[model samples]
Target: MEKLQNREISGKQKVRSAEVGTDILKALAELSPATSLSNLAEHVQMPASKVHRYLQALIASGFAQQDQVTNHYSLGREALMVGLAALASMDVLKVAAVPLAELRDALNETCFLAIWANKGATVVQLQQAVRAVTLVTQVGSVLPLLSSATGLTFAAYLPEVETAELREYELQADSNHPLADTAKYQQHLQQVRQQGLHAVHGLLMPGVDALSAPVFDAYGRVAAVLTVVGPGTVFDADEAGMAAERLKQTAEAISWRMGYTRP
Candidate 1:
């Protein structure tokens, strides 16, 4: 029994050491490309002596480095390798699968994720709410460039060269379209960018409300679009409502996991 207790204590100590190491490494990355030891300790909320001990171990493991002259520390080559590997392995659909399900459960609305393709915003994944009898869209369904909250979000973030032809075609197809005027359309796109999300009321379907937000990748490109659909009364409140905030938070978390940091 004494031996067993000792083994348990050893295991716990090793786990704690690992947690501290990771915390120190995170602080190093947050304060990078370089930061003084004092700053790092304060950032991690650890004593300078304790942090210094961890830094010594990190430097030994090639996960961190300290300038010989200035004593400032930064993430080392091994840390870079680990970060690149993590970034490379991340997939938007896989990363967002759980969050999308959670968001659907929280809002009790049909939620779907889409990616920009030659056909425009194409639905790729979906989570259906319990009460949603009729599906709003399905996998491989290509949504309209001007009529959908998802499409407008992709348009607002994606480069003009990729969307120009479609925009022109959509405009010429409908002469009386509200967004037919170039200036007016640009203004609408600007609003989506400024607000970090786009919402539509019954444009995609009658008596339905949909809100969409963009998921960004490491390079800050729009990797996917996340959208939620419900009956018109579901989102009676404006953008500041609980549903919109939840959508924004979910999208932002997915973006962060995909390695995007807002500049």
Candidate 2:
């Protein structure tokens, strides 16, 4: 079986190759139909040869369509077909994009939908603000469980043993860090599990703030974390608190769409 990991935004492979195949799919997704191969190579910074190989693989797998006239790439029919098929699957990633966009637009900040990996949080989807800011997160990236709202919320909801293991592996060991201690995070996780939400200030990146809430499946297992992240300057304490409440409500709505009902 392939292991899952949250990779940073630098084109590093933190997830399995099969999942990497999906990364290719997503990169292609964020493009106009019939993007030139040279453009994609420059965008992803891979050699054209490697890009061609991936393109061939994608073509073979029906995830990409090559234009005979333009000699460029478009999403293959099978890709769209599978995307439609995925609507009924357990994964909320494919189903959450529009809601995420709505959340981003409403909040005027970046939003993310993340799933639990064995070690940390894997960002399955993201919506960026139209205005430029300096945070370096993107779709298909991963963040440490102790450092971001998305990761912390997922960690808080995880089984105690698994949570502890992630802490042991991913949490920074320096005592000066706010979340460095196992016991402190255990207490924090208790609060999150109770309130059904989590918020952190300046944790993932200094001067940035984030709020997150879990999305649950029909069986009441957590499926993902819906997060809104912004700069602290954009959201002061009172405003951040309001956003947290909204995040919790939005997460609940998304959870309901995934078949989870609040008890």
Candidate 3:
């Protein structure tokens, strides 16, 4: 009878632990941004002490974080990783197919999509122009950050720390390029951020020009860059020109499809 009682107690403890964990996760999912311990306890209908115990476990497991300044709890990096993995598994190319085709037709130039691969921006998709033209870039080409418009678009929107690292690497690698000048390079990036676009003329290759814009993910991070490339004579550099406007519009549309909402 003592053994039977012990088994019953152990089963009850397991059920209680599971319930507490589920309640905490559900409360967190419902709460936006973050919530204080007392408020979370109230929302989960659990005692503060019990909720605190579960929160500590969650924090240790990287499912939650406690803000040091505010003493509130929020979802942590692991939660974001789970969300990103789910998103990455989706068919992004399928979602982008229509907009890419439309942009290519409207601009009458080659269109390409570059994603953040391993360490740099790598071309993943391309829609060729109707008219035959000599194209140097391929599907798997990793673009130079200080030269290609697509790479510049990524540099403009990525987090400052990441951009700083890339800048250092680029400067060391392309010491002879004009963008090696820190002041001028920063000013150029600022302009790209303000305009939500970037253009390069004869930077990547002589007589070649490109315009590019960033596509944001649900987390408001740059997920990819969309670019239009052609001969310098035809690929106008005017910020207010039709091509620029169309490129920006198409990028915004693609960002929306990727679940980015304007904050």
Model 2 has an lDDT value of 0.77
lDDT (Cα) of model 1: 0.90
Lowest lDDT 10-mer window, candidate 3? Answer: 86-95
Measured with C-alpha atoms, the lDDT of residue 116 in candidate 2 is 79
User: Model 2: runs farther than 4 Å from truth?
Assistant: 1-90, 171-176, 236-240
Q: What lDDT does each candidate get?
A: 0.90, 0.77, 0.85
TM-score of each candidate structure, all chains considered together:
0.88, 0.62, 0.65
TM-score of 3: 0.65
Write one digit per residue (lDDT tens) for candidate 3, span 14-107.
9989888878976886785899998999998889998999889989989889999999998888877876886786555766788999998988
Q: Could you give candidate 2's per-residue lDDT for residues 45-81 as a string of tens digits?
A: 7788887887898899888889998898878989989
Arrange candidates by TM-score, descending: 1, 3, 2
Q: Pick the candidate with the highest TM-score.
A: 1
Ordered from best to worst lDDT, the candidate numbers read: 1, 3, 2
Report how far residue 139 has shifted in candidate 1, in Å: 0.5
- The whole-model C-alpha lDDT of candidate 3 against the native structure comes to 0.85
**C-alpha RMSD (angstroms) for model 3:** 9.6
Clashing pairs in 3: none
Model 1, stretches more than 4 Å misplaced? 1-6, 233-237
